[model samples]
Target: TATGKGFTPAFVQASRGWTAGQWAEARDRLRARGLLDADGELTEDGVRLRRDVEEATDRLDHAPYEHLGQAGVERLTELAGAFTATALGNGAFPVEHFGKG
Candidate 1:
């Protein structure tokens, strides 16, 4: 909602299975929490909130493979890219997934 174009009602409905009212309520809560401004832009705290959440999510996602180390992670990404080439060229990105025998 902050950096990109805001979601349309249809997009929110289709993607999140949320009605417009539900989506608005979610935004309202964010505003009430001081994470968003009246205009729906992210406040400074909102940016930090997003960062914190992303960092935590990243940690949680990687916690399972910390023992793999940097090298292992790189190889995993490369293999994942090859495996998901048809669907997503970005590979191992949105997913920490990888593939290759």
Candidate 2:
């Protein structure tokens, strides 16, 4: 879905530590499911599906943050934001590829 959202397969593979074959297989599967087009772009349904999955993932991941409480969550976010910015600036990952929605 990252590729469908405008990331390159290479970027995804590199960032996520997936092999080229694995990425290709996943892409093919998504395409077969009508989530991706022949050109590897996301169809409308693909976009919706991706958004739904992200929402569901966020819901599932919320428990850890809740356990931290509001203030702790805020602090963690602040610290992580700084780390992320530094990583972006340092080119720890492809910013252009990862930054797209």
Candidate 3:
């Protein structure tokens, strides 16, 4: 979800619950590796890294819901999509990142 422009430490911390220290260390590493800028925006390399991470996490996130079956998955997806749309509408998320329309 963060491969888009303006990816930042705050965005990740809000979702991943990382500690300050962890984020600091990660920020340093990202800069040294030319993945992120000082402000935490992803560089091109960072975008690639984020894409890979997102792909892996997407798979992991899907497994637990496998027991829900196809119809259940569809229902859950619809609900989740609605929530995301609402979040976007309320300016809780960047439309460019979350908008599927």
Point to the candidate with the largest TM-score: 2
lDDT of 1 by residue, 1-101 (tens): 55333444454465567877887888899899998898877899999988898889897887646878889888988988778785566442332122121
Residue pairs with backbone atoms closer than 3 Å in model 1 (clashes): 80-98
Per-model TM-score, in order, reads 0.62, 0.75, 0.53
Candidate 3 lDDT over residue span 1-101, tens digit each: 23244445455566688888987887788799999887766789988888898799998887768889999999989999999899868898674433432
Candidate 3 residue spans exceeding 4 A from truth: 1-26, 37-40, 86-101
True-structure lDDT of candidate 1? 0.69
User: Model 2 Cα displacement at 46 (Å)?
Assistant: 1.0
Off by over 4 Å in 1: 2-12, 69-71, 83-85, 88-101
Candidate ordering by lDDT (highest first): 2, 3, 1
Clashes of each: 1, 0, 0
Q: lDDT, candidate 2, residue 51?
A: 93
What is the total number of backbone clashes in candidate 3?
A: 0
Candidate 2: worst-modelled 10 consecutive residues by lDDT: 1-10
TM-score ranking, high to low: 2, 1, 3
TM-score of 2: 0.75
Which candidate leads in lDDT? 2
